[model samples]
Target: MPRLAQPAGSEDAQDPVALLGNLVKASILRYVRSHPGSTIRPICDALALVSTTVQPRLNELEAAGLVTSDPPWAEGTDRRGIVVRYSVNDEAVTDLYLRLGMALGEF
Candidate 1:
């Protein structure tokens, strides 16, 4: 992995229509990848994001096949807990990161 540069808002927002979507997706993917085996709580904490703010992003990433929720596990009788730990679906996200870096340059 190359030393990934921090994304600057100005850099990411450049050509907003064509690149912003991928920039946001790449940001989320990098977040998920860095926090492997992490639940939304940690993600929120690390990014200073609210649950409401993070949930939709998580849903978007999951829907895009870049993340998967852990299987439900028994908590007690007649109860179960679902924990979602996100991981980067390596190939898709890494490729996006590479492309975005090449196209957008660094922050």
Candidate 2:
């Protein structure tokens, strides 16, 4: 079997399943799943988290392919800034669900 690549300085790298074990990350994922196409400001307001605190978690989720976002730099004037909308990747969510279920012997 091939070894999975690990994010530098990430403790969850050894066990991918540990990604879902984080309360903040889990909450962020759930919020993103529930509120697809939400922007950073709304997410921060809804979750009562600061942008600095939530940005890294969003980056991690995006890096792991669990979430996606609009291009940060687009040609349109309306789309030119730090604002990026986010949405959960349904396929990735389902895969995670199945893996978690199987690990828990629920499947």
Candidate 1 residues 1-107, lDDT tens each?
55755455645434332322544445666787877778878887877768787776776666655666564322342322556677766776655556567656652
**Model 2, 1-107: lDDT tens per residue?**
54867556544233447656588888888899999999988888988999898987887788788889886322333644656889999899788777776655578
Candidate 1 Cα outliers beyond 4 Å, as residue runs: 1-26, 72-81, 98-107
Q: List the residue pairs that clash in candidate 2.
A: none
Count of backbone collisions within predicted model 2: 0
Could you say which candidate leads in TM-score? Answer: 2
